[model samples]
Target: MKFEVTILGSNSALPTTKRFPTAQVLNVLERFFLIDCGEGTQIQMKRFRLPMSRINHVLISHMHGDHIFGLIGLLSTFALQGRKSDLHIYGHSKLEKLIRFQLELLETKLDYEIFYHTIFGTNIQTLFEDDSLIVQSFPLKHGAMPCAGFLFKEKERLRTLKSDMLSFYNIPIKNRHGIKQGDDFICDDGEVIPNDKLTKDAPKVRSYAFCTDTAYLPKIVPIIAGVDLLYHEATFLKTEEKRAKKTYHSTAEQAGKIAAEAKVKKLLIGHFSARFDDLKEHLEEAKNIFPNTALAEDGKIFSVELDRD
Candidate 1:
């Protein structure tokens, strides 16, 4: 029932003394998902004490070294550790080639099979979905390499049963699930009990969005609107707006603008340029527009509570 993201590395292309490259782990009810494995991602994951073997799905934003350099190391480690579960990776087609090429060069065979899913196009696409969670990949406007942003949405939970009501009606345990799922309960005597009288409202659906290595593309706002938490890359400050535009990156101010326009409950700005010795200015610029902004610091955890605002 837990939903949260752990920031592993928050720096941009370069690894600074204070921060590593871009990486994160999203845990949705113990399903670990690795998002954008950048340099030193393995070390960061170990430092954070996340169970590396539990991460079955990996999402790569783009083939940029800063975004995917650590994938080979992670895969190699999995082999070394004798992993058995089949792994899945989602990204541009080239991502699979890169990993396969490296593995072939090493002449090392892994015990687990890897399934590479091609997620292309400049539109939103479903990557993974289950009864409890759905993960979608949306295009990120970052050059022609075909980067992607991700959206994680938790499905609406069933209603909580009213204990007193259940006992009052002597509802059978076998019928409780249907009652929680909004089905009316029929007594043994053929009396119908409205579902609302036996159960409270279902928990609200929650969501999180991850946008990185992209420009200020407002089109994505619709896809990520009203997300409980949004982690958008802020690679520079407004002072370097032109550079950010040229590199297809976003400034902290621009990140804030997107958050404000999207109406997300909270915003986390990261992917900081190595040139920045301190991130106070970056936080300040983003907060100027979206007051609920926080820096995506390394090892920081951002949780999406079930309650809706």
Candidate 2:
């Protein structure tokens, strides 16, 4: 069961020599979920060797051009590739209209169907779920536009049956599923074999949170508390705190503080402003507040695993 995030683009409002914009791909157990689609996202995906066919869901944080400008191009490319599976998009209600208008105006017809799930208002809500994972959306304070952040949580895994004990108990193959679900086994002699003795605890549930293009809001701490990995936007340095606040973006230090307050295992800061030529200052500012912080650079991959400690 692999869980990881690959950064496609990390720059803020503009594309730089190295950075594109805001885009990421969360690979949960081999299934790809795209988060944001800034300009050049397809190129970045190809550069990183990520297969476009694997991405079925797209999560847009906001309506900002830097955050979603690449969606049309990606979809068109998918069509050109003769994709047949439906693509699901989760975002602000207005996004549906915007995408439809663009596709219609361009007279672009795709072979696959597009399903839009509208996320309305600023409330915390569950956006998607399956037997293995759950995705929740929460509102972010991003000025006039309706913005959101996402939390991805893996479901509690089934316990692993002890191989030695299974043979000793002569457990039937058909009963494995029940035992993994925490059921006790009954022997031929009617002896009860405890579930704990027959199986080992499964891996701990892992979680990741994505927060970007928002101001410093402490209320989100409770929603994303104790996540394994947190990707928060650090669009500016502490020296430009006023500009960050004015634009409803977070400074590097501010993003670090949020990670500390949320008690997440690791923090990834990105969405860098194009004005800066280097990220040394941003990394320094964030690391000063949260030592576990890492810079989110394009093509970087972060794995999400259980925090053994």
Candidate 3:
């Protein structure tokens, strides 16, 4: 039930001494999702002690070099390590083509299969889902590039059964599953026992949204609204708003505004410009609008703890 996101790299297009490009790993119930593999991402993963073997889903936001340069290396390493599990990559058609071209050019024979899921159009749609979790993709305002934002959502779980109550009512084994699914119990006397009396509330559903390398986009508010944690790109400060617009990147203030509008619980700002030697100002700028904002540092892990049942 562990849920957390580890920042592998946090720099923008440039690779600074303190920061690499953009890369992250989201671990939900040990199902790892690698997001935006920038240059040196493999090294970062190693440095952070992440188990690369656990990563099966790779989500690329776009075909930008700073966002995807390290992907080839990671894929190669997976082959070198003799990974057998099939890897599922989600991104634009161009990304699949680029990866295919590189793999062909290198003549590298992989030890596993790679399944590509193309992200197209501007509509928000489910990219992956299961009984306990779901991941969706939404379009970002990165000009000319088919970039996307991702939302990771934990599904509502079954109610927690109270052992003492179940025993007291002599609930049948066959009826326990239904009770967990929010059904009332009927005794031999035909008395209906309330579900609330027999079970505790289920854990609160958690959600995380990742939005990077995009311009100030308010249209994503509805899609990412009220998420438990939100990681948004702040590639510039408000002093360079015009520059941010020109580069189709967001400023710290803009990121904060988006978080506030979306009403997310916490905002994580990253994708910093190389010019910034210190990120204090960027954090401050974001805190101006969204007080619960924090900077996304390389190798840092932000965890969302499970709710009490």
Question: Each model's TM-score, in the order given?
Answer: 0.96, 0.97, 0.97
Q: What is every candidate's alpha-carbon RMSD to the true fold?
A: 1.4, 1.3, 1.1
Error of 2 at 202 (Å): 1.0
Candidate 2, 215-289: lDDT as tens digits? 998999999999999999999999999998999999999999999999999999999989988899999998898
**What's the TM for model 2?**
0.97
Worst 10 residues of 3 by lDDT: 118-127
* Consecutive 10-residue window with the lowest summed lDDT within model 1: 300-309
Q: What residue runs in model 3 are displaced by over 4 Å at the alpha carbon?
A: none
Candidate 3 or 1, higher lDDT: 3
lDDT of 1: 0.93
Best by lDDT: 3
In order, how many clashes per candidate? Answer: 0, 0, 0
| TM-score of model 3 (CA atoms) | 0.97
Query: What is the RMSD, in Å, between candidate 1 and the native fold over all Cα?
Result: 1.4
Pairs of residues at least 3 apart in sequence or in different chains that clash in candidate 1: none
Question: Any idea what lDDT model 2 has?
Answer: 0.93
Whole-model Cα lDDT per candidate? 0.93, 0.93, 0.94
